[model samples]
Target: MSVRYAIYFAPAKDTPWWDFGAHWLGRDEHDNTALPQPLLDEVSPTELASITQAPQRYGFHATLKAPFRLAAGTDEPGLITGLRTLAQTLKPVALGPMRVATLGNFVALIPHTASADLQALADACVTGLDHFRAPLLAADLQRRRIEQLDERETELLSLYGYPYVLERFRLHLSLSGPVDEAVAQGVTQAVSAHIDRLNTEAPLLLDRLCLFVERNPGTPFQRIIDLRLQA
Candidate 1:
């Protein structure tokens, strides 16, 4: 059984970047419109299509905490309470603008630069929520180890179910499925064109973090909680 809990921020539709239609059509990659052109010009069409077809599943939000299975005997309500408690101390991060690009074999929107506020928030979530994460299952450890992850990666995964967290974490909004080098070029071009049209002359702002939870495996992740930044 695989269950996950995540923390992410989302922008509202009233913002200049708002486009419910685009977000709905292309998934959350619509948020990637805020990314720089050079990066957008690097993705493949098939990859972009796959990502957009299921955007909410993959696109547009900075992950505060990566997914992890609930520890033995844990329940959802308790987890929710922990999350809310964490939220109380967190002020909203002001990420003025961000870049969109490929994360290894995947496409996503990320900050053109990093922010200290963002880092602090990520750290808080990981540490505060540590008690909820189960230790890595043998299968998870084996699969990640096969990826030749570094010592830090191994350690983090063992502790948090992901190698990247805290200082190593960067924000991203996913845009495509995994693909080969040949397909990557076209996907980049198509997504670049789309992003160009969406991001004209304004900076993109992240206003809120959304808690998207999957009801079950293979089902679409739905918004279970929406946390706004305290002004």
Candidate 2:
């Protein structure tokens, strides 16, 4: 019923991960670009397809603000302006060196150290733009598995519309969806190898804010804008 939008931190276009992940997931979120999967050694396209299918729709990125409907009176243009204003005030930092790690059944790239700057940025994104977010529907609450959450988490979910935030938020660039331990291990090795080859020394400044929109239900989110953070 309501249009959904999310605030996400995606790799910048020139970053190796940007195009590398795009081809791996076979979807370019910026322009909804699609490409055939590359020939991965020891990993077949079919296997890669199955493991990545879940995260593929969203493309490759970390969720800063989980998707939500715009608050009743809010409009897209206003939200965009509000986001730009917020970005301007937040300090930027590079992601630094990251390595592949397995969180549950998914493989992702996590920074060697938790950067306070990154945490502050994520916290601001969640709390700052919250007023523009419509309350979650009952079904949405159920989907979050509220019964399994602790008291504090339930409260955050009620106030913030998502449980993973504040203390719970883990900033990781996901590379695969759910898979068995063996498969996850394999994916982790594969991702690590790719990152190792990249050998990026400089950290990506976490200044740019991207607005991703779900134009319709069951549709892939597209990057509508890259709002720069100006001093």
Best by lDDT: 2
Candidate 1 per-residue lDDT, tens place, 66-147, comes to: 7667888787888887777677777876564544477887666666688888788888778888888787777767766647
Which 10 consecutive residues of model 2 have the lowest summed lDDT?
A: 198-207
In TM-score terms, candidate 1 sits at 0.75
User: Distance from true position, residue 159, model 1, in Å?
Assistant: 2.0
CA lDDT, candidate 1, residue 88: 71
Q: After superposition, how far is residue 214 of candidate 1 from its true place, in Å?
A: 1.9
TM-score of 2: 0.94
Q: Would you estimate the TM-scores of all the predictions?
A: 0.75, 0.94
In candidate 1, what residue range of length 10 has the lowest lDDT sum?
A: 30-39
- Model 1 spans with C-alpha error above 4 angstroms: 13-48, 51-59, 142-146, 181-183, 191-202
